[model samples]
Target chain A: MDIVVKKIVREVKRGNQDAFAELVDLYKDKVFHIAYRMLGNAHEAQDVSQEAFLRAYTNIESYDENRKFSTWIFRIATNLSIDRIRRKKPDFHLEDQVSGTDNLDYHSQFAADIDLPEDQVVKLEMQQWIQDEIMALPPKYRSAIILKYLEDLSLKEISEVMNLPVATVKTRIHRGREALRKRLGQA
Target chain B: MACTRDKQQVINQYLDEEMTLLESKQFEEHLHSCPDCEKHVRELKKTTAIIQSASHFEAPKDFTAGVMDRLPKQSKTKRWQQWIRRHPIVLTAAVFFLVFVTSLSAGFGAEEEIVVRGDGHFIINESERTVVIPEGSAIQGDLFIRNGDVEVNGEVAGDITVVNGRHLQASSAQISGDIEEINQTFEWLWFEMKTLWNDAVPFLTPASEEE
Candidate 1:
C-alpha cells in the first residue's frame, strides 16, 4: 500500500494530474474526520479538508519521502484545524442546560433537524454531549486525544502529527482521557 | 503497594496497553485489590469508546470532486512562471541564458559528429553525414547541424547553429543571418531544455480551453 501511494505521488510530481485524485480518495475521510472532530462543524471540516489536501498537493515536493505520507498529510490537516479553531472563537458555550440561550437553540435546532426516534435521539444527544466534552479540551490535548483514539494513531504517529516527543504525546493523551472522564462524570 | 497517585498514571498506560506483560499482571493484581483503580480504568475505557464510536464519519460523496475542482491549475506554461516566482535569481540567470542561447545555440554538447535538422531545403549526403546547401539554392528558416558538417553554398534566411560540427561556407554563400558554432555540456543541457519546451508547447492548451 505504501508503495502504491508513493507511486501515485511520483506520478503526480511528474505532472500526471489525474493521479492526485487517487491520493485524495485515499485520505479524504481521515482528513475530514480529523477536522470534523477538531472543529465540531462539518462545513468547516470540509473546507479544512480541501485546504489540507491543497496544501499537500502544492507542497508535495517538499514532503519528505522518508516520512509516512499519512503523517505528513495529517499534520497539515491538524495544524490547519487548530488554526481555524483559534480563529473562529467557538460561540456555542453549553455551560449547563439552563444557561446560554444560543446554546439551547443550537441543541433544540439540532434535535429538530434530525427527526430521529426517541431512543436514537437520546443516543445522539449523548453523542453530542460527548462531542462537546471533547471539543471543550484545549487544542493541544484535543489533537493528541483525537489522533490517538479517534483517528487510531499510535503514540509515535500522534507525536509525528503533533510534532512532539512520544513521551509528551503520551502525557497529553493521558491528560485528555482524564479530562474527558471527569467531564462525563465517570470519575 | 501502588498508591492511588502513582497507580493513577499507570491506569492510563494500562488502558492504552502500553505496559509490558509483567507490568500489566502486577497492575491487574493491584486493580483487583483496589476497587478505586478498577473503576477509574473502566471509566477511562468508556470515555475512549464514546469518542471513537460516537463520531466516526466519512467525507461527503462530492468530496473528491470538490477537491479536484479547487486544485490549482499548474499547467505547462505556469511551470516556468512558478519556478521564477520561487527562485528570483533563476529568472535573472534564465533571462541572460535565453538571450544568449536564442541569438546562437551556445550550449555545446559532446559528440562531434554530423547531425542536421531543419525545414530548410538542403542537399544531403547521408554517407558523409554532411548537409550541403547548393549554391544559389534558397534555404528557408533556421538550420541546426550537430556532430557533423554543413557546406552552406546557398541563401539562409535565419541563424545556422552547429553543435560539435564544422561549417564550410563558400565565398559566394549569401547568408542572411548569424552562424553560431557551439560545443558540449551547458549547451547540451540548453539543447535538451529547448527540445522539451518545444515538444510541450504544441500540446499546451489555454486554461480557459479546459473549461
Candidate 2:
C-alpha cells in the first residue's frame, strides 16, 4: 500500500471518520461511473454507489492491502448492481415508462448537444450503438465487458473485482465481446 | 485452426493488446492467412475503441459533501481515548496507577499494620482490619495472615493469604500467584470499589490544565 493509503487504513481502523470521508471522496466518482454504466440509471447508480461505500466502510477491516482499493470498491458496486438487476421483477411496461418520460427527452437532448462537434459525431454515434449493444447483453456479460474494456482493468484485477478466477474473467470478457459483436450484426 | 472460435478469442485478446508479444505475433500470423479472422479482429478493435471512448458518467455534484454530512463526525479525542482504553497493557497499567494514587491520597490509616514481607508477599499483622497497597513495590511470595486484612503492592509472585479478614485490596497488584482466603468474613469489595471509582473519577475531578 502507498503510505497515504496505509495511513488511511490505520485511521479507519482507529475509527477516524474524517479519514473515511476522505477515502469516500477519492473514489466516489469512479465508483459512481461503474455503477451508472452497469445499472443505466443515475438514481439507482447513486444508491448503489452509496451502498457500496457504506459497506466498504463497515467492512474496511476485511480489505486486503495487497489489492487496490479501487478494485475492492468497484467489486462492491458491481455486486450490488448485479443483485439489483437480478431482484428486479420483469415489467414490460417499464420500457414504455423509460422512453415516455421527460427524463428520456432531456437525456436525448443532452446526447444530441454532446454530439455537436462535427468530426466526432460519427464516432459518438458508433459509441452510442456499441453502448446500446452492451446494454442489451446479460447483466453478467455486461459487467465483464465494462470492467475489461471501459475500466481497462487487467484480467486479474477484473477477477478480483468480480470475485471470480482469472480464467473466468478472461472467458467472460471474450464471450461478452463475441455476444456484443453478434448483437451489433458485426459477426 | 484458421478460424476456430478459440482462435478468434485469442485474436480478440491480441486486438485488445492483452496478449503477450509472442502470442500477438502468432495471432497475427494466423490473421494474415485468414481474412475472416482478420476482419473479426478489426471489428473487435473498433468495438473496444467505441466503449473506451464513451463518456464516463459523472456523479452528482455535492456527492462527497452529502455523504460526509450524513456520516457521523470524527472526534479525534474520542478515538484517542478509545485507543488508549482498548490496549490491555495500557488499561491495566492505567487502572493500577489510578488505584495507587487513590490509595496514597486516602492514606493507609493507622488502624491497619499492613506489612509487606521482604519475599514479595504482604503480611497484615493486625486482625479485623483493612490493608491498602500503594502502586510501587515488588513482593515475591504468598501473603500469610492469621486474621487480618491484606493489600498488594506492585507485582507478587505467590498466592494471597487471608485469614478471617474483612477486606482484601488487590488493585494495583499483579499477582502471579493465586488468591487463597480461609473465611467468609474476608470481603472482596475494594477492587470493585476502586474500579467504580476509577470509572467515575474523571467526571468528579476538576478540569486540570488542558493538554
Query: Against the hidden reference, what TM-scores do the models get?
Result: 0.62, 0.58
Collision count for each candidate, in order: 10, 3
Q: lDDT, candidate 2, residue B95?
A: 92
B1-211, model 1: which lDDT tens digit per residue? 1256878878877887879999999999988988888878777778788787766889999999998888887777756655566589988998998897664543343433456777667877867868899887876777888766889988887778887777899998987778877666677667767667766884574542233
Cα lDDT tens digits for candidate 2, A5-73:
767877887777667878887788889988888877789889889888888878988988777889889
The candidate scoring highest on TM-score is 1
Q: What is the lDDT of candidate 1?
A: 0.81
Candidate 2 RMSD computed on C-alpha atoms after optimal superposition onto the true structure: 14.9
Docking class of 1: acceptable
Instruction: Please state the interface RMSD for every predicted structure, separated by commas.
Output: 2.9, 2.4
Off by over 4 Å in 2: A91-128, A185-187, B16-26, B72-211
Model 2 CAPRI rating: acceptable
Q: Measured by TM-score, how close is model 2 to the native structure?
A: 0.58
Score candidate 2 by lDDT: 0.71
